[model samples]
Target: MGAGRRPSGRCLHTGGIVMKVSYREALKMALREALSNDPRVFLMGEDVGRYGGCYAVSKGLIDEFGEERIRDTPLSESGFVGAGIGAALGGMRPIVEVMTVNFSLLCLDQIVNTAATLRHMSGGQFSVPLVVRMTTGAGRQLAAQHSHSLENYYAHVPGIRVVAPATLEDARGMLATALENPDPVIMFEHNALYNMEGELDETAGAVDIDRAAIRRSGEQVSLITFGGNLQKTLAAAEQLSTEGISAEVVDLRTLRPLDDDTIMASVRKTHRAVIISEEWRSGSLAAEVGMRIAEQAFYDLDAPLARVCSAE
Candidate 1:
């Protein structure tokens, strides 16, 4: 099997022949596909033009699409972010890269009050087809300022959709779906997963924006998580399996709509649950998952639900 490939009675194969793309390349391809398919689609962010983006995900895009469509903005997250929202209001599908989620705090007013509330406040008269992409998670010791998983903050809002693209497929397909949605969408890409290589099945269909995916299934316990903690949870699951505890891992890709049905189904089957999140333990998304499990699957539980969240 390849590094990321799962066996299906075929012999092992590697050397990147079957799976030849990096996570960053997958995202770039998705953006390229979106721009090619939609005439109104454009990207704007700091250093996105000649600088090739902070992580180089936008590298060469400006060359192909020209400076007009792949416009670069100043270092003002609040200004460009608000402008992106305004552009969306004016009938444009805008993909605004915030560089990092920590910096996105500067634009919280626009993201929360404007982009998130416009449609509801207008009684469905308006829509913001905006996609804001940002790097999230910690591990490189970029310190507190440069590193933090703020997906929960976005998920707490009601109107905006929060998504975390964990796998290559998600990294590839989410941009198009977010662009198509009539509401603002915030995509959190873990910094640690950018270079991780994986397969890209061109024939694979688009993943739903409101569903959870079972990456690995088991019966003894359920390990629920999304985003950066996904790989860690899978590692923990494998370790648990060594001791005879089979862990079912559910990737809650969409946090806001939160495929509760998928979570409930997994909990029902496994009867034991543990949620892992990189955000601080207090009032995090993990707590929300635990509460829902208590409310709906309390009687099905063989033990109290467990959680492993970060402490910052």
Candidate 2:
């Protein structure tokens, strides 16, 4: 019988301890840093100002930066998103929050059609250096509409970068990297991770938004996942370890440029894989990852790939 699973503890390096922050606080700090460091950077979203923020991640920002920088808009997602694109084109770095992934669909045209295609359509003459942040994943039982995982939709789009921060370090560093990029970037912050607490390793700053991270090392199987499912997948890995199955946990931090090297390396090493995701199995990010593994590491795999996904 499988033993009870002990949750995997967060990694906190204390060699040169600076400070620790909750996931939300880390995000706030990142936002503050971006706003302070760059006069061009501004945060705009629904209730992001007076109301603190949809998730309070932008809390206290308005006080420091004022309403001009921490602007709040109406319920119109498309209108605001389009405005963000225009703002970015006007030489401003805008961080637009869409409340949640469910609402982001209202601005699909702006995100997919305009923000993504501008640089290419203009033959590199125009660049949309914009960053869009939104909450994703379920767990709070916000019902059908509010609770859904739609990261795969954004990852599927071309000319835009998609990233998910599953740890404190990423939460603190990803935004800075996104702000510097010339292309549009979509950042998905798992709704359930807002309250997560961990120490930010001060040694690491401005992490690359183009690589996958190996959360845990193992030999028997590879457990690949991202966003909200990371902690749960790590816990599951610990459970498998008790049964003599050494499972490696790989966090696909950046979904768009899916780090083939890191993913293939793990798959080739473990020889077996299990992809975990909160999205439905059909056409999910997990499915794409599995396909990539099969295409590149088929000969390295000793067993068929597996996926643990949401129920249909």
Candidate 3:
């Protein structure tokens, strides 16, 4: 069985049961499960309820949960998103869906200034148990306006957990974890991965929202990335392997409480690092990681850190 799948022997068979689901389907299931399990949980965004979401990830949910719980807000990103933060503060768990990360910029004030700062500013008196979901990345050639990976922007903020659900397991588990967090949480789903199907294990546990995960092990060079760049990094790793350079791939699943120890440990073992990101190189997350490597792992390095970031 693949890493994402449970063994066939472990499968439950009450009377010959068989079913399959895609990554997108798994995400819907997670959302539906959250709604069914908790009345406090509700979804709000443009086209989310009646239109079935931009990618159809929320399809059929409106009928099941009704319009109140599964709401379709107006096209105003800042207005509706800010409203979500307010709703969360009012003791409701709102899963605010931004059509895309690029559009999320219009509501940066709410996300960074409001949702992220509420808990700390209130001295823990208030908690923003909110989840903001947005599609990110630039593979479909949607041009600049529609295509941008803004996970780094969110990751740079404090008091908010930034997550990228790269696999089927993460797609299924991240929603519940995000809701459980007392602070705000942002989940970036790569636009390119919505239809990429993978098997989902029934017993998969909640992935740590604060730790980096090593997706592949190697000994020569380290390829560190998250979100949509992960697949590119892995492909680069494989190509480098053929050239006699084994590349270890590290997926920084959660960018806010960055698992720097895991990243540094990998760098210590490999002695070389290559940070990859879909964001532009200048002032990008890759640049931040490179700076950290130089600061902490300067003495342990075999060579200067390298980076492969998107072109402006």
Candidate 4:
């Protein structure tokens, strides 16, 4: 949306003003802005350079920013992640792409032991301004290895910030805010959302990462969710409207610092809450949010808090 660049193809809705872009294109816009606005920012990951990213999100970045800025690392996840952390420590802002959520496990030690703890361990002397972007969520197109929604695993850690952008505006804006945070940030881009198309204003830029967004408002019930499930929940809400069920939708955009205030506000208003998550039921983010709502808004609920999660 800035003078630097715009999404690849253009689509005019009405009045020939607004721009329509896919989730992948919006992400490319975000990356372009981050590279243009700051000198220290750079991207490094597998297939990110010559191959144009596993999902083709970085398709044209290498030509525009060059190989040095749009770098491609080796197959070793831990090694490259550790190098990213070191780059952050040395005053460079690094955005590392891990290809998928499952592959991120290969570098868990570097992420948890080093990147997540370095600031606390160094007594605030070190700050890892690193952003790790990876594909998450379940889909049949990509095999089992690339189909796991493991964002909850990263959200479980104490030091890093976890965010999933489910909308075009968020996909275009969240990266800048994540890059600005002094601590580490992990961005989970659902594989299924890559082709999603939506409209974004010309002036759209960075967005908030500290609060959850209330996507829809109602009174009968609240449909709480994030990531790809937000679209499913909103669609379900539309179907529920035909049945005379007024459902509110809350998007937990930021997973790590769960916005309890927003979640409780919705729960108290609806008096009934159902958290929908793509992760497995046991120890999922839905479980944690359900507990928070039950603990804080117990009296307001007409029935016990509920969760609809992946049975697998």
lDDT of 1 at 30: 83
Using Cα atoms with residue i matched to residue i, what is each candidate's TM-score against the true structure? 0.93, 0.94, 0.92, 0.96
Alpha-carbon RMSD of each model: 4.7, 6.2, 4.3, 2.2
- What shift in Å separates residue 296 of candidate 1 from its native position after superposition? 1.1
Residue 299, model 2: Cα distance from true site in angstroms: 1.1
List candidate 1 stretches off by more than 4 Å: 1-19
- Per-residue lDDT of candidate 2, residues 139-236 (tens digit): 57677888889999999999999999999899989999999999999999998999997666545468899999999999999999999999999999
Better candidate number, 1 or 4, judged by lDDT? 4
Q: Residue 292, candidate 3: how far off, in angstroms?
A: 0.9
Instruction: Arrange candidates by lDDT, descending.
Output: 4, 2, 1, 3
Which tens-of-lDDT digit does each residue in 1-312 have in candidate 4?
Answer: 222366545556565556778898889888998998999999999999888899988887888889899999999999899999999999999999998899999999999999999989989988999999988988757887888888789899999999999999899999999999999999999988999988877668999999999999999999999999999999999999999999999999999999999999998998999999999999999999998987899999998788998887
Q: Against the true structure, whose lDDT is highest? A: 4
On TM-score, the leading prediction is: 4
Backbone clashes in candidate 4 total: 0
**Model 2, CA-based lDDT:** 0.90
Model 2 poorest ten-residue lDDT run: 1-10
Scanning candidate 1 in windows of ten residues, the lowest lDDT window is 1-10
The global C-alpha lDDT for each of the candidates, from Candidate 1 onward, is 0.88, 0.90, 0.85, 0.91
| lDDT (Cα, tens digit) per residue for candidate 1, span 225-305 | 998788888998899899998999999999998998999999999999999998888889999999999999999999989
